[model samples]
Target: MLPTVRHLLSQPDLDLRLLTPATTLPERALEQSVEWVHSSDLSDPTPFLSPGQVLLTTGTQFDTEAHGDELYTAYVARLRQRGIAALGFGTEVIRDGTPDGLVDACLADGLPLFEVPYRTPFIAVVRSAADMVAEERYARHTWALSAQRAISLAALRPDGLSATLSELSHQLHHWVALFDASGTLDRVFPRDAFAGAGLPGTSFETVQREAGRLLGRGQRASATVLAGGETLTLQTLGRRDQLRGVLALGGVRELDAASQDVVTSVIALAGLALEQNHALAGARGHLRAGLLHALLGGSRDLAETISTEMWGPLPSAPVQLVVTDAPAGRLDAIIEFLELRVEEQPDRLFFATQNDRVVLILDRTGRLLLEDLCRTFGLHAGLSDQTDYRDLPRALAQAEQACERSKEGEAGVVEFDDISRQGVLAFLARTDAREVGRATLLPLINHDELNGSELLKTVQVWLQHNGAFDAAGRVLGVHRHTVRSRIELAETLLGRDLGTFHARADVWAALLATASVPG
Candidate 1:
């Protein structure tokens, strides 16, 4: 321990009289050698002492009566130029007091003045300075040890959580945990220290409260554990964004100042490492999503990647197609979660998230998985007819149509045939171009005003039977001649012949269009 100047002057029994009480002393640092002895005897003492050295003085070298002011002025100038550490004047030889001019000079030069009492020994002052240095070293060493232990509390082995947490618990001598944002333990130390702490396995929302706590006033607080018979101090181990975790340390040493810094570094490192791993995995998932999109976007076959990999074979696949996205913003987590669920289900051939929802081609023998999926995902699904792998596009279209129909009115999953009203009622819903082509034959539909005109009814019957006059007469409850006359009247009204199949088709189509229009 090197002695400081002020500490050296505070010793007992040196008989050093107080000299310059008002002189400004220069700053003093520790001296490694006894080289300060040479400067003690010089007339202009400061020129011999190194800059920053503490220069203690006695007035023995100067002839005060004849040369006092000149010698004093020279000494002050040299002290100022050399930057001596607070020139101390022992008054024993200089008339028991520092000269006023020297005091004023020291003050103007901005140096510090100390008055050493007659009872203090300069040697005793040296020993005291040495003691202070030793104490400071001890304090720094203690702080460093605490820092090491704090870091160890958050470290782990590559094996997994149990080993890491157990070691941390032992190091901190308290239970420690790395919880997801949900306050559910992602990992815990001491194996059994955390029994059922409600760590969420699949969602971070549950731990958001804990995360918020760590971010706000921080997790540092005193915990009274009656069962364990120990009081623990909790410290948040990271900044708001980095590795966020609650650190539990036993015995209330309070993690010291150095430990906090160490914990900050450790948490930052953990956050970085975890994020890097997540980013890499996300990149892989992105590649897979891109590959799926390319397959679904074009005419390319997905045979080599789809059933061949995710599913063993595509037999009797109980497939469902879905199409919905959150209206608020783009769907991200929900989409990924649903896709994961497809793989986890009991029997799924494979799942593809194209057109917003998963199109699950499942093993028909295991149809129960579908119900479970719908319940879990809370999404509407369009179950399609189990078809061959090559026919997936057709099945997909049917499922999409069903979903569209659901949007039309149902507000739930749709079936392919549920919206297929066009089969039996095709003519009722004909498009405008077909309806316009039949406009010329509308006159036959309105000819019932003619006398004894079974003509309109006959035309209707003939059109209904596809121009079969015998069937038309049977349907009309009349003879073939009556049916023929009606057809002739219909032809006359329209100024056209209705004897042929082509003319019959035109009249029938017109009657269909007239029936479909709003009355």
Candidate 2:
């Protein structure tokens, strides 16, 4: 703390005495902090003085005969306006004692006034105040060093991140909060800090919104805001491009240089802790991916054992698998959210990311949670039908196909059951099925290309006409006999009898599957 007027007067070496009645001084005026002690004798010393400084002067500027009471009163007013912490009048220089007019003016204006004995030189007072300021500065520096060391030790704890935050709050005497990369409040020091402080709810909300804006920019940043009569400082942790989280301090309107050093140390430690956690989370993610691979490869027992040992049980059989193509930027947030859910309901939800897409396996009752995830991230997801663990590979395929189909629909999530209800054509609209259809008709395609015959078209018309030769001929603008001959040629080339219903159905299905392929 800076030296106060009361502290200065209490010093015996300075030999200062209160000129104005002590009781008349404004509330806490005697305790006003003295930044520096400056001696000036100018009639108007306000120009040379700053706020919170002790202004010392000889009585030379005051002339009772020439300026009278008005001069002294105005001088006191000017000093007050300059925010002078206290006024000191050196006696027996140009005048024998402190002027009565000046004392009366100070009393009236509520400015603390003291008399500096002639025995005490102005330089002595200046030196005394300077030494006090220096001592306070040194004390604060020591505190900062000690605080940083404590915070560093806290960072070595098992719960290092949280321990560091708690230590920071203790050192700063302010509440501290940690926000995850997704701008969600992950932890707060002193659980009742905000509530016990009685801060307005909107204040916390404003801080949260500001945290979100900072994380949303995905850059290193800091922000200061005033809410509910308190000051808050927020700093983003980690690198500019890969922000790990945000650290916020409440009740800190500003930080002194020394305090800033302490806070900087805490930020560095917290950032390192978060970086370590991020690396560990990445490793766990890779493990999850490997586990998912094992599940798909039909090693259900091994996958389950590993998963149970690491993160509790996997979702039971008769689970619905969901696959989504969410954007890269939002994938981290999605995974983080799912991880929290998995922690809470380990046996009901599990997720992993592979090939730039997220795969989720949740119990059948988790449809609402899946929907919420899709809606929250604006994701297009394909959900597989409830299936046992043994059929995971088939389920994964179904989910992938449905996910592709979801892109063509308006909904954010589409289930395999919904796709199944569409018809056989919907199921056939896949890469493998399309390739098979193309190969099935390749013989006819090659025969038509080389001979310039209308065999393919004739077969298509005849199929559309439901095997009616007359109807097919009319549509093709050819005689019924010519249409029959073309159909015969198509059958020969296809090596399938068009006379049987099963063969006809197979040919029609192939034709539908390859409908979009260029000839």
Candidate 3:
């Protein structure tokens, strides 16, 4: 609350009189804050003056003998262009009274003009404004300290995170929102702050998109965004390597240094709360994993008792088991999202992690949720057929196998039933049969690697064409005779004849088994 022109004029000791008609000046112009008071006698003082300062000058720059309106107008225009808050003209010093030309310039330019009597020194005005600024600064600093104390107490509440944010919003007289690690809006203070169309210049969706981008980078950072006409500050919470969430303050155009300090304190408190919650979540995750192991070990009754006590009930008996290999970097975020989902529909979904893999047990109706999870996380999953709780071990085995198969496709999720329909070759992908096939094709593999020959590729292509030499040659971009020669050479390396269907079948299986293995 620095002194405004109106405030300065009201001071009895100052005895400043408005030279410009009070009615002619805009109310906002008169109320404009004066950051400092500067007195200059230079003809062009704009170089030393800053915006929002009251410029005081005696009539020394103007020649009293010369009544040139242009000189006064040009001088006033320069001060206006520099954004000087107001002009204070000292009268009875050099000239007899305030110049009528300067008064006319101030009126026409809409600059507030005041007259300082010769009895009052310019230093008195400077010190008066300085004391006012200091008082306001001190008041603001005290408010920040009080606000921080209140917020710290709020963090001691049972719902510390939400309570702290609510207190912060109240203190700032603005809105505050928290976004979880997955970029989901966890909560917003003053709950109805965004209830309807939301406040002007602040769109929750736009803020959320920005938060998502920052969290996706997985680093400790901060961003300031100007939306519509308002300003929003986003600060990442937690450590750089393990960010817990993002804290956003909206409708703040700018914060004074004191306000910024308060916000910093809130960020630290919020981050600590989230970290404590994370540790608790990790403990619960281990418990869930133990239940999953029990379900797979034929202890269905025991697992059900424990799960019912914790998360309502295990997904009803005939449930789908989904498995995915969770990347280490995103594992925490992934778990957090799943935990949120489970909380929303406790009876329909349950998840646990085992050795870098996440296993989900979902009711038949929860398939869509599983699909959404995979799509959102860019994960590949394998879903097992719905099976009774008693046979969860079999379902786990099937889901693990399908998860491996899902990695080879673009669908993101592969079901065990789909693989079963694909016949024996699909199942053989992970079998000991792969070793046998690799053994049978070892000679071709060795020859291709050693001689830079196309024997293995030619054999695979030829078999794919069902033994048609011309078709294989067309695919290999070689002559039919050369294809035949390569196939004959492959037969010699394997000590087998290629004319029979049995030999061709074995070679094709061998090729399929070694398809993913490096040459």
TM-score to native of every candidate shown: 0.36, 0.70, 0.71
Residue-level lDDT tens digits of model 2 in 1-519: 677889888888988899877788888898888899998889998888899999999977677798789998899899999999998999888888888888899999999988988899999999988988899899998998899899889988988998999998898888899888878777898877656432456567778888999998888999988886778889999998799889988874466678788888888888998898889989999999999999888898898899999989998879989999967766667887898888888999888999899999989788998888888878889999999988888999989988997886665888898878866764675445777877888888888899898777788779878999999989889999999988888888889999999888777767767863221
Pick by TM-score: 1 or 3, better one = 3
lDDT of 3 by residue, 210-249 (tens): 8999999999999988875567889999999988889998
For model 3, the local distance difference test gives 0.87
> Residue by residue across 1-519, what tens digits does model 1's lDDT show?
233444444444443333444232334332222123222747865545686565666657767687767666677778767866556665655566676766766666555545544454454544454455566556655755765564555454453334444544554455555653323345555556545444643112223343446545543432322223334444454444543445443333344344444445545555554455446545645554554455355423564445346434333434443443222222334444444554555245355444455555556543465555445445555666666555666777777765554554433455666545434233333434345644664454345454545565666667667688899888778888877776766778887777676776665555555553221
TM-score leaderboard ranking: 3, 2, 1
Whole-model lDDT for model 2 versus the true structure? 0.85
Consecutive 10-residue window with the lowest summed lDDT within model 2: 194-203
Candidate 3 regions exceeding 4 Å error are 1-3, 6-31, 38-51, 60-83, 92-97, 104-111, 116-146, 179-225, 240-243, 300-302, 429-519
Worst 10 residues of 1 by lDDT: 30-39
Segments of candidate 1 deviating more than 4 angstroms: 1-266, 290-318, 322-332, 335-349, 352-359, 365-377, 402-519
Better of 1 and 2 by lDDT: 2
Q: Rank order by lDDT, top first?
A: 3, 2, 1
Ten residues in a row with the worst lDDT in model 3?
A: 196-205
